[model samples]
Target: MEFFADIADVAQVKEMQEWLPLDGVTTNPTIVARAKKELFTLIEELLAACEGIVQVQTLAYSTEEIVAEAKRLVAVEPSRIIPKIPCTQAGLGAVMRLSKEGLRTTVTGLITVPQGLFAARAGATYVAPYINWVDSMEWSGTEVVAELLAAFEAYGLDTKVIAASVKTARQFRELASLGTNAVTMPPETYKTILEHPLTDKALRNFADNWNGVFQEYKLDSKLKG
Candidate 1:
């Protein structure tokens, strides 16, 4: 399964490359604006920075606008960017049309299990269900994650359940255990994984020991000549 972080800043994009475990990225108007970069310009930069998937949302609020945005996103570079649509009927219609055009579409918002199912029915490539947003509203947020994951597998939808708005490592673990295909976090949470004490302890222990460690060089006396 692939993992993604929902970061907007190009600086964060470079930071993620340093940590290097995260697999992809997702951007919306809010996030794209955070980086102080134009939508198309950000997409171009992301295709260069990230060696993984880039899920880019269309700014259009309606089906017709979304279709136009999808065309625009595809025109830049089809391989890297997946067109993201909201979970409205018009968005679903746009998803269906773009999907038929052989463009990847992701459905995202405050998604319920049924929404994810509907998105899959529309042939969406990714279904983004909000985790932190759901919990903050006092819902059994984790259950929805589990439900969608199972529903996709059971119904044989090609859609990938990407846990969205993940706030912390625990939530990341929760979605992971549910067999979610990916989780998109903010840059802070992405950095948090590296600051974990356990990971630090493991490296500390390894560096402190050198019991009979040996090294050999295959290079010749004159620069391996």
Candidate 2:
């Protein structure tokens, strides 16, 4: 499974690079704004930072407009970019065109399994279901993930499922358990995964027990070797 860093700032992107062993990034217009950078500039910066795919979303309201913009983004580095579109009819059409043209597409804003099914039919490279949002409505994200995965596989859809809007560590684990191929985690939540009780206790115990003899040697080893 792929762990996608969902962040807005270039600083956070750089931090993720140095810390999180993630697979890719997931971005929307809001995330771009949060980064406090221009859309294309942020995309370029993020693309440069990560070795994996960088998803740049389309904020266009119509298929034609989005497709035009998507074409431009894809022209920059088609293989490295995943064009994210909404899970609407117009978005679906744009995604289908992009998919057929061999541009990777991620259909986001998914609320229901049927919407994901539509995205799958459009040959979306990834389907992002809003799992946390579903949970807020007292719905099951797991059911949606499982259904989409099965439907995509059984019907020969080329689309992959990416569970989105993941909040807590439990939600993250649930998404993974549900067989999602990828998930987008907010920067804070991603950091939280490293702060579990076991990790904290282990670090604390090591720090309390250490006599500091290995610090210099470890630093030298890291720097020299």
| Highest TM-score against the true fold, candidate | 2
Q: What ranges in model 1 sit over 4 Å off?
A: 198-225
lDDT of each residue in 1-225, candidate 1, tens digit only = 576778767677878778667677888888887788777788878877778888888877889999998888877877877888999989999989988878888898945889889999998988888888888888867789899878888988888888887877788777767778877877777678648888889876764453224232222322311
Give one digit per residue, the lDDT tens place, for model 2 in 1-225: 888888757677778778768788889888877678778887888788787888888888899998998898877777788888888888998987887887888989898989999888888889899988888899987788889888988998868888888887787777777778988887788888657888789887775555343433343432222
10 residues in a row with least lDDT, candidate 1: 216-225
Q: Which ten residues in a row have the lowest lDDT in candidate 2?
A: 216-225
Off by over 4 Å in 2: 206-225
Q: TM-score, each model?
A: 0.85, 0.88
lDDT of 2 at 67: 97
